[model samples]
Target: VSCIARHISLTVGCCWLDGENQPHMKAVFPTEKAVHDHFENLLRILSYEPLYAQIRIKRSNDETVLVGSSLIYFLFIVQMRNMDWLSDLNTTLKNTMVSIIDASINDEVAMCCYGVLCEILTDEESKDLSISDNICNYFLQMLEDIWNKTKKKYEHVPIMMLLKGFQTLSKNDSMQQETAVSNRIHIFIEICDEYPIAYDVIWALSFNKDIQQQLRSDSPFICKLTQLSRQPENEQMSKIIDGILWNLEINHENRSMTDKHNTKEFDIMISYSHKEKVLCKQIYEELIKAGYRVWIDFDQMHGNVMDAMAQAIEQSNTVIMCMSEQYRKSNYCRAEAQYAFQRERKIVPILLQKQYKPDGWLLFIIGQLLYVDFNKYEFSRAMQMLHNELKVELMAETHTAPVRPKEDSVVAHSTTYISPPEVLRSSIVSENILDWTQSQVQDWLLGHNLRQLSRLFAACDGRSLLYLSKYMKNCEPQQILDLLEADSVRRLNESISLIELSSFHSVMHEKKKRLPSMYSSNT
Candidate 1:
């Protein structure tokens, strides 16, 4: 009906169509609200028309006014049409947009504009969509300027915009200018530390094949930035890292899929108290029989139980905590359990003792997790249930969700780097801060999964990020990358920036002068 009215209006030209009176013209809408309604109706009809499609900004009084975000509303449809259409929108217009983004006073409006722009740029409606270098640079410069000037005010929003802008830039194969990308990334990481939005930017940047490759072959900036970003929300850092590993595994699986090779089996460490060792052993043996390798730490540590624990947990598929009478009573078990819990591992607790419940204060510590029970001698049934559950959970966490390319499966949302929502918004508070060892950070990251990492990062101090960075310098690049993941790297990226802002960057560099650079001549 709206389309028919619009078509009749166009045919009649400068005339309003009437509902009755036999194809007669009616008076124009007198009120603003009525005019808005008529215009919105017209826009709805215009959206379907081939030529007028993708027109979110309209010109009527010789001014480019935002229409309905209707273009972005139908973003998928527009994206399906042709991304080349975006390139045709005139570079001058994009430049004007850059100016508008810079000059805008209303943060809300600026955010809306930013959203619209990002929606268009990252639109996945078209397979071969391309964004131009000049436009990307314009947004990048705008973001950089905002970061440098508004560090004290609106500290976080800029980095998110910068990240989204960079995402579009990163997608441009033509824009693979290594130096430019690296410098932008460096500045981005720097700003992320001071501001709360670093995670989004770093997360987006890590998706770029070139950026990922460049990061691997690190220079000093990359090494420092990588360490810094992995510092915060150690738990999130772990998830982001796990997400990366999952991606790598998916890639590996794709390469090996055709050969019908057996899926690789992995060992998981079971850390329990001596009293629960029998139950733990039962679970461990069950896992081994089900085709999973298992590791159990029964006795006391020889040298560094921390490192040994870290190594064991890092190699495992999951960490099984036998939450029983002995585990609840032993501080050693609880401490080790907490450490493994922080590493983003798939933790399964076999509830053994009905009398042993987490305490009142530990309620805050334990959250609302429901543990599997195996307190009785129903060992066989419990073992079978554990095997099935472990198999499913392990596969889901480790494997990428299969994709149907022809159907345009939602762009593989698993990021190469992931971060928690909190890290992108706030700073580390005093109460949450804890002085932790490097080995501790590694164990925390390698042992837990994403959900747990968010809580751990939230509970950490700013110093912990730098501490982790320094500690990680001793580990191999692959090991570090495996532990940090892209999301964690992003957090570390921001942490580095915060340190620099506090003049702690210089302090850390001075403090760690003896540490060998990952990007040094060794590469």
Candidate 2:
């Protein structure tokens, strides 16, 4: 009787009564032919249903019996792992197993049931079982709850096994499975945050084009992953997150570039010598007000100066050269022009000085390109010409101007330039100038060039220049030109004419006499 009970507990706990349970009993009791013959009629009369019902009745009668019955169900699941019983599980039996899992608090029993469910869900033979979405959601919810509660307390082996099972289920190419995985991206990110092991799951999901599109659209989630990737403690996690972000950013940029109306980071990087800064500054301010993203050195001061310049040139769509005698003389300015030319970045040269003509490397770089001539026109007129030229250049680059409908008398120009909307105007013109305290600004003016100082003083009060100079001290001499330009625009109530090179020293001498009290205070 004990032998019969043990065999019955193992065979009948998970299987239904009518179909395969009787055949399984015959296999378990094969050596005891007489015993099997003796019990065949009784077993046929009382199949798995009556036996399982009796176990439940006993379990309800005693707490210890309930635990024992759970262990019996757990053991039956473990034994069936080697067998192909997944497809044979009917809806009622599967529900009973899930119910046992829900009611039990024992880790062993719960884990065993979880393993059984994972096996069945992932098994190829059970693909046609028609598992409901509600059941899958409930199963995942229970697993997540358990993981949240015990993940820190226990080893990750059991949780990893469950996650591996989930990854396996997602590996299938069916639309339903793909949809299921895509809907849980937030959950997957949570898993990634909590368990580094789940990064493989994220890596796998990224290969699916649809999943990549979904992640790209969800910027906040991607940003969270980016913040995690920047942490210094975990190199492996950082690399994986970086790869995911790279894939997402590359795909997003490719799509955006195809639509030519999209605005990029910077339209141009203004490269010039500090000697020609006064005019360069004016040009910079005008470009900003006109809605072009101009990368001069002022706003990009976070890293090594040369690297920053190179990166800016690479990121910009074109390089705007404020060409002059000083631009050709300075090694740093020459380097910027050569680097831009080598990178195949469009070079738009604006002649800043009247007598200066391009030669040597400058001539080699911009000699062939048509340039905007500031020398020939009045300041405002020259600016309008430059603006118009920029419009033409941008139209040529984008190749996306809208066409007018055909008319009998009108000719359609496919390359017509359109003015950018006012809303596209850069906030750099309106954003607060770099934060600099008054004392820090005073320290920078102690030994600076008189002409640069005169220009700074003209644009702002001595105190404001001193304050603004604190932020400008680390900037390259060329970038300081841009900062001075932006400062002059932000603080000056009226437009100042560009200082003439020949008269710059004489003007500085006059300005020096007017600011004697300022010099005295500094002394």
User: lDDT of candidate 2 vs native?
Assistant: 0.50
- What TM-score would you give candidate 1 relative to the actual structure? 0.28
In terms of lDDT, the poorest run of 10 residues in model 1 is: 412-421
Q: After superposition, how far is residue 108 of candidate 2 from its true place, in Å?
A: 9.2
Q: What is the C-alpha lDDT of each candidate?
A: 0.42, 0.50
- Which residue ranges in model 1 land beyond 4 Å of their true spot? 1-117, 121-131, 151-183, 207-209, 213-234, 241-523
Model 1 Cα lDDT, one tens digit per residue, 1-523: 4355344434333321221131322244444354345434534443343322223232231111232222222222222222233333424333433344454444433443444454343222112323333444555566666666745323223344344434444432333353246356666556655543454344444544655565445465445544643554454443333233222222122221121122222335676767656666666665655545556654444332334444455444567777643354333454456555555566766676554554421233346653555644267756644543454345343332222222212112111111211211222232211344432332333233322232224334435655555556676856754554554444322212222223433433553465445213222
Q: Residue 244's C-alpha lDDT in candidate 1? A: 31
lDDT of 2 at 472: 49
* lDDT score for residue 342 of model 2: 69
In model 2, state the lDDT of residue 291.
66
